[model samples]
Target: MVCGLLRPDAGSVHVTGRPVSTAAGPAKQLIGFVPQDVALYPDLSVRENLRFFGRLYRLPRRRLERRVDEVLDLVDLASRADDRVESLSGGMRRRLNIGAGLVHSPTLLVLDEPTVGVDPQSRHAILESVTRFGEEGMAVLYTTHYMEEAERLCDRVGIIDRGRLIAEGGPRELVQLVAERDRVRLTAVGDLSAYAEACRRLPRVEGVARGGDRGDVVELVVKDARSLLPDLLDLAHQQAVGIRSVEIDEPDLEAVFLHLTGTALRE
Candidate 1:
């Protein structure tokens, strides 16, 4: 909606003070949107794909050529300028998708899960480029399922669930909302449901559930995990649960999500 790709049912959308919903097309010039899927020509060369998009923005020839090279450098694809999109690896193609949107240098960049299917190296490169974009004065609205990415990149975050905006604030500010609690995960082998119920009755343990693909991990939200460690171990022993590992985490965005929505984010 912010990118003017979809119409908001109620309120109007705006970018750089321009009304995105009401404006015909000019408002979009101030924004660059890169969707989760790659958008590029398979047969086109890396530099060619960029030039094509730049020309659509009506960039002058000289400036278009210069911007193409600059974008390649920024996306770490300078050496693959002549490689066809189909010939590139999945990660490399993802980089070009981002570069295509950045050709005209819009003031607002909206990336919707830009690293969803890319390799780790490409994901890191994309995150680094986004940091550089903010450093260079571009406002970036990044959306992702990765909690750590949100914690690491965003200055402000708006969490949406069931098609509604439930929360919005700086990452630290949101995390501080749940600072009194801790997220704890215990890996063990036993009757998980009974163990989870047992943990819930323990003092300072606010919530408990069985998680993990095999439901072998007991997850809990506690006031202070360190103080309750001994008690948790005693309960596990009584329940005949063989503890394999334990992790106590400080409150973070995932905890904030579970606090607000009563469930984990779909990873």
Candidate 2:
């Protein structure tokens, strides 16, 4: 909608004070869209692909050449500029995908899961490039299902679930808005029902229930799981709950997502 591909059913979208409903408006020129899947020509060289996109924006030959080189360097694909898209590694191709959007240096860069299906090394590189974009004062609308990425990259996050804007705030603000607590999972050999019931009676534990397959684990939502660990362990020993392993999950964007959406983020 922000890119003006689909018209809004009601209301209006304005980019930099210009309405998006008008085709060929000033708003359209200020946007650089990066799709979820790669949209570059496999047969074309990296530099060629960037030039093609730059030409679509009607950039002058001299300016286009410089911009192509600049974006190639920006995405750290300058060394592979002459290589064909098909010949490049998955991460390098993803890098070029990002560079293609940057050819015209649009004021607003719209990235739709630009890091999907890339290696860890490439994902790290892509994230660094995105960080630099914010540092350089480029307005970015990054969309992703990865809660950690949103938490790390965005200054302000707007969580959309089932087509509704359920919440919007900085990471800390959003997490606090949900009022979720830490989760502790204990995998044990003994009966979990009695353990769960006993855990529920604990002062720090807000909720307790059976978790994991085979009903051998207990999940506890606590005010501060780490601080209450010693008491929890002592209680487990007293109750004859043979704990095999324990996991502490801190409250984060995932918890906030679950709170607002009534489901997991991936769901």
Candidate 3:
């Protein structure tokens, strides 16, 4: 809305109680956005990129240089400050992008999939930086498809699907919606679909899902797995299923997603 890129047809977007459509300078100055794609001039060095963004905010010359150095150090890219954007690796470039966003010290930082394709090292660094910003009391609206990342980074997560927010809560609270006390996974041979149907009818079983190829592996959520094991095996046997291996897994976010959506998160 600030750049005339996205506009609300009916509703409105407000920043700091001021409407974003009309409040460009003041509202825009208070918010920093880090897009999913890296947006840096390939020809410019990291320091030069940060300086250019700082000048856009009309930062004082002396203070702007200090802020640039501070942000570079914050992202652990101070050593590579003079390196051209084209020469840096994917992770380094992502860090520079984050650094550029923080140059103006905005109160709110909106990060859109900031760690989409970076290596584990870079991803870890970016997450750490965001955590640090939160610790410093910066309000952040981070959006991503990775549930684990959201669980790890956000204090409260808003789960959006098809442009609608389906669920919003603390990670633990969301996981509790699945009604899963524990999970039991069985690897077997035979008619799994029939066996899964039988498990679904069981009083102890809360949910059932096919795991791997041939539907050989099946995971079940139940109230008490220890007491239900014998009955489950008996059901499999009744269906002419041969159990090869069995393992119990604890419930996590994936189970919650499955329970709420009736589909596996991986799918």
Candidate order by decreasing lDDT: 1, 2, 3
The TM-scores of all predictions, comma-separated, are 0.89, 0.80, 0.78
Clashing residue pair totals per candidate (backbone < 3 A): 0, 0, 0
lDDT of 3 by residue, 38-77 (tens): 9999999999999999888889999999999999899888
C-alpha lDDT score of every prediction, in listed order:
0.88, 0.84, 0.82
Task: State, as a TM-score between 0 and 1, how close model 2 is to the true structure.
Answer: 0.80
Q: Which residue runs does candidate 1 get wrong by more than 4 Å?
A: 191-215, 227-240
Q: Relative to the unseen true structure, what is the C-alpha lDDT of residue 94 in candidate 3, on a scale of 0 to 100?
A: 94
Candidate with the greatest TM-score versus the true structure: 1
* Error of model 3, residue 110, in angstroms: 1.2
Worst 10 residues of 2 by lDDT: 258-267
Number of clashes found in candidate 1 = 0
Query: Which has the greatest lDDT?
Result: 1
Clashes of 3: 0
Residue 57: error of model 1 in Å? 1.6
